[model samples]
Target: MNWKKSLRAAGLVTALTFSLVGCNTEGSYSPQEIIDHALQETKEPLTYYGEYTMDMGEAGGKAQVKEWSKDGKRRIETISENGEHNIAVNNGSQIIMYDVVKNTVHKIDISKDGLDDFPSQRDQLEILFNTVKDTHDVKIAGEEKIAGRDTYKIVAKAKKNDTLIGDIEVWVDKKTWVTLKTITNSAGNKMTTEYTKLDDSAKIDDAQFTIDIPKDAKVEEISVPESESVKLDTVKEQLGEFLMVPEENGLTLDGISLDKGIEDRSEYTFNYSKNGQQNISVTVFKANSNANKVEPVFGEKEMDIRGQKGSVMDENKFRSISWQENGYQYSIFIGNSELTIEDLVTYAKQMTIVK
Candidate 1:
């Protein structure tokens, strides 16, 4: 239970408390109703400002965090009791992070929503609730007051197994549909957070996100996704002459996107649909950079893929196989689609390079 690890996940859960306050009705709220409101907030985005304290009991860590988001720009300031402070601002086009005490800045340029991956905070909350809604016992426990607002306490407990996200208890705002507080116990690791101040309707000054770099501050550069979705017909030209893609496909081609490379390098993502869902994707990029190559550990079995050797490994919920050929790297990510290593190897063998 390293609090540092848990602290990384807290920022995401804290997002569940950032929506607008709903009207406080006279009656109580059902677990389903509360969950629906949270899911709905995903579709309707809002501007918000909040400050909260996180106490990781026993694990021994605490921090004061403040958050603000308006339009597509966002900022987060975190301070520890020991006087350590960090401020990061994402203003659509780039991310600027500065260490106040150290006088150092790290900057990364990104397109609007360029680096944001799938399953947004709202989506993650929706998925968490929907996954346990039918499988677990969900009910509103009682009413409580938090952050000066009346809230309904909803608890969801697993029936037989303590696995699926363990048990969750959340205090939702009565007027503002946001979650004011939450306590989650997953496999014996319990985490709690409470918002001390929140204003979803706050008129946050845009200048708050703007940072003026000092003349003598040290600066470092970082890379991020600066690409957009490209049409299939235009992918070849965008890939330049050095890149190639898989020639064979059994599933429907959902779409293709290209990441503008930092150097003379670029990557192409070919997404394929299965059962009306995009379940398979192949990422082709240059193998020259260490960032693009995937090395297999020793004693690990290797597969003869397209006359070249590669290794297939379990990458979280995805089964990925990354190999290099013709000075380029190709990684196929198929959701644990019940595809055995042999099946994966066979698919790779059947692939023909299309220049």
Candidate 2:
């Protein structure tokens, strides 16, 4: 398989594996108790080698993953589909990724960029637990046998039926709290993953977390650019005189971030917040010549914003509006706020070029 197909399959597996499970009424432990127990058990450092299979509705593949972590250092070795070997190592301060097929290595410094290191299994599980706690109703389904070990089955169903994830089910290893099997449904498509082999008690050396780049491999250094905060009056000085902003909205200017876009073009991002909670972002960049010819995604509808033809997409918990004006393409994103489509359209309609 090509790289893009491999990446798509990997993404599908990740989405399905972490999708939240649903609740049952017959288990001995309360849903919250089970989640808390699983969270607490993930704090320990350990090593595991496992073989797993991912089955999407239209695509399927299998891989072997060896993971080890201790004292904030972590490593993962994956033999993905088509026998592609990939290695990632994080030593608390930096991350190095190596691809065996391409014979290339890429390094990023976490400390200098103000970014966190690569996430470990415990971190992922904590995120999953928080997602279940905040958005879904979870229950301990029952017990099951996975990879020769007894496990607890948990299910989580989203309170909102229109979410991308319809429902999820997971079988958690009783002793380690690690997930062994996961099944998820999203938009009428189903995906499942199961661990065929697991060795949690393997002794791993600290050197296992380190990667030595080969002499013949090509090396690339990834740079994380910093954003500059500019005053509203200076926006026209940086961008052009044609950029627009809403003057009457309750949203307050958080900051403006400038980044490099395609072919060295400059992109400007405006950040706004309401009552210190609701966050809204607007991005403006040079519009491609073909931008007007692109087709909208499913469920998006054509609309008129400020007399410019645009598209509006509304999902379960998020909404966005995009349009091309003059020589720029602008997009506005509203995330998980109480704002409705009418509110978003009102905001869009009130936009005026800064004088």
Top candidate when judged by lDDT against the true structure: 2
In candidate 2, which residue ranges exceed 4 Å CA deviation? 1-13, 16-27, 41-43, 54-62, 112-120, 123-137, 158-162, 185-191, 261-264, 275-279, 290-304, 307-309
Whole-model Cα lDDT of every candidate shown, in order: 0.65, 0.66
Which 10 successive residues of model 1 have the least lDDT summed? Answer: 1-10
Best by TM-score: 2
Q: Which stretches of candidate 1 lie over 4 Å from their true place?
A: 1-17, 20-26, 41-49, 56-60, 68-74, 81-83, 91-94, 108-115, 118-124, 130-135, 159-164, 185-189, 199-204, 221-223, 226-355
Error of 1 at 79 (Å): 0.8
Give RMSD (Å) of candidate 2 vs. truth: 5.4
Error of 1 at 296 (Å): 16
Each prediction's TM-score against the native? 0.59, 0.78
Q: What does candidate 2's lDDT look like per residue over 12-41, in tens digits?
A: 543432212223234467666666655554
